[model samples]
Target: MKDINLTKEEKADAIEAIKSYFFNEKDEEITDLSASLLLDFILKQIGPLIYNQALKDTHYFMTGQLEDLFSLEKHVQRK
Candidate 1:
């Protein structure tokens, strides 16, 4: 599957949604049941793809930055 891309705001929204699910609904008589059900719903709705893409994109940018820094350091040492 093609990777999912989430903007910063989308990421923040997703986190807030999960937190609300846990906190706001904790007093339900079947709290454990409801929490598990909601968590699964999230996973099904937008969990795996978004999270994996975020991780992969972050790694790609970090690797590029590291390479650039290493090259700059080498050039500086040579000067």
Candidate 2:
């Protein structure tokens, strides 16, 4: 399985981007603190749901289940 490693700066940037995108004022109108709560909900709930596909891909490779599918498409031909 490929290691899921994020550098410190990448992690920090993602956090800040989420905060600004969800919570900051839009078109001069301020949103409520629900922005923060919504971000929290998404990170806790939706994030994992989205990551599940990656988990499946990784699991298959780690367990040798991807051999057939991966081998079906030859890298030499693609190049």
Return the lDDT, model 2, position 11. 54
Best by the lDDT measure: 1
* Reference-based TM-score of each model: 0.40, 0.40
* Tens digit of per-residue lDDT, candidate 1, span 1-79: 5444557676566656666755777642434445455556766677777878989999999999998887766444553
- Alpha-carbon runs more than 4 Å astray in model 2: 1-15, 22-32, 64-79
Tell me the whole-model lDDT of each prediction, alpha carbons only: 0.66, 0.61
Error of 1 at 18 (Å): 13
lDDT of 2: 0.61
- Residue 66 of candidate 1: its Cα lDDT? 91
Q: Write the per-residue lDDT of candidate 2 for residues 1-79, one digit (tens) a residue.
A: 3334457676555656655765564533323455445556766777777688878888978779656667788566553
